[model samples]
Target: MFIDGRGHITLANRMCDDIFQADTSEWLEHLYYDCIHDHNFVLFIQYVFLTETHAHEQLYFDDGWSVKHYEAYGTPVTNSKSQLHGVVVVLHDITGVKRLEEIRKDFVANVSHELKTPVTSLKGFAETLLNESMENQDVQRQFLEIIWKESDRLQDLVGDLLELSRIETHNFQLNLQPIDLSKIGAETERLLRKKADDKSLQFNVSSEGNKEMIGDAARIKQILLNLLTNAIAYTGEGGEVELNIYEEAEFIVCRVSDTGIGIEKQDLPRVFERFYRVDKARSRDLGGTGLGLAIVKHLLEAHEGTIEAKSKPNVGTMFTICFPKEWSGW
Candidate 1:
């Protein structure tokens, strides 16, 4: 803020001080635009003075070191005599929020594309079946089967989407109990054994400690199933898939690793996002709902746990789930 007519600083907030990286005494006598790098800010100040009205605008500036965006709002100050005084300016930081909004929009578009493909396929096959005669059973049966499979895929996708929403909103309550992480890992391995066998992959599970925790046993099982199934899905014949359970600090850590087609560096961070696929065509062909990792992420959060991935291209990916042991009430 500066004096109304003389353009001399009357007061400046801490934020403005930080922006200019100077003390109030050093900058008090300076014009409003004296410390601003952008010429537009100077023009904006002049316009506000001319109109004698409050104004709000976005300003971009650089200090020869860093660039920043500021949402600036200036309100006219007046005394009891109705004489114009200095303007009060407020700056808000919105850069992070803007970036997140962009990400959310991208996620929505991706999900729409993911849902559209299967729905279109299902609709087309159903229409084909309806247009054909039942007497020519083979063709009718083929189309019907395709329609049925696509319908089931759609149902699974919808269910996962709903689960993701519930988990995010904390609507899914945990039926917490004392559960052994090793046992859960073993059960998941057994359940996923068929899948591994189908691909001629080797499945293994190991534990280094008690591997026990208090958590929603069902949700814990779901988390294991998703990770193990993901491993089986990506691993090739003769490859090895391993589940390692241990206690790390105050958390129960379970790591599922596979010798499969590893994810690229750029894709690792986004793998937990809904409908995010490294290979869209292949993911569809494999009947992936594209919500598996997303669901896993939400489940971990609901459990007050965390999950992370470490991978290298053409090598493999390791997903680690860490559950807070203190949360285990059982």
Candidate 2:
């Protein structure tokens, strides 16, 4: 659209009409203020003139069908006499790029936070042992033990974070092979049985129709471990955690259900977000880095799968994953 320095719409190209889904000629000669009713946007335009600089922003249209991510440049046009004419504003679409940038920034921030917590604790405990080596043998031994536990926690956190990054970024090549889903679930249960027992929780894994799916066994096991660990962490002692596997219409389905501290309605949406925890204090106390659910979300997505969560306060939470049947052969 062509507008004068006074912020009026003088002319609009056919492409602009198509992009906005607006009728031609009707929108012509309309003041820009009439089209943009958002107070913030009006202020943005006012700021442009007040500051005399290029400004860029995103605005959602009235119809809600599109979001306009535009960078507008206001340059004073000059006539033959070197006099200032009017500012010409150009708009570029960058909605997709903006979304990608936001995702990348969030991913980086989450990874950094997850890595920093365990590393910081490990470093502090290790330094404590070094500083008080001979003060008291018993105290020194306790500090050393703390340092050892912290180190192990740090190692697990780092390993899981790396695996998540690799899977999410597609940096690691998968050795695709056919495998039995039941067997995989069983193996996961066997590996985590001791931990589940230590917590006095009941772990149950069952398959519907004894189905088989194709994928990397190790990666699948990693997914199970992450989910189970998360469920167990949130669940109280004597709670039941169940892993159910089945075949859907054209997908393989796996659901992990736990009688745990159920997520609040508000927090359910953010559970998959990296470094997001409904109960931050409890999560830290339970040795959770807050990257487990995020890793599960990414790894499942990498396999062309989808994951969803449902929960109710004081009831429980269930995480369901659906993998398309096409991957059964891949």
Candidate with the greatest lDDT versus the true structure: 1
Q: TM-score, each model?
A: 0.77, 0.73
Worst 10 residues of 1 by lDDT: 1-10
Residue 122 error, candidate 1, Å? 3.1
Writing each residue's lDDT as its tens digit, candidate 2 over 90-130 gives 55666678779888998788777766776787788777776
The lDDT values for all models are 0.80, 0.76
- Candidate 2 residue 243 Cα shift, in angstroms, is 2.6
lDDT digits (tens) for residues 63-177 of candidate 1: 7887667787777677898677776667787667766878889878877876897789988887766776668788778877888888888888878877777776734687887
Question: Which pairs clash in model 2?
Answer: none
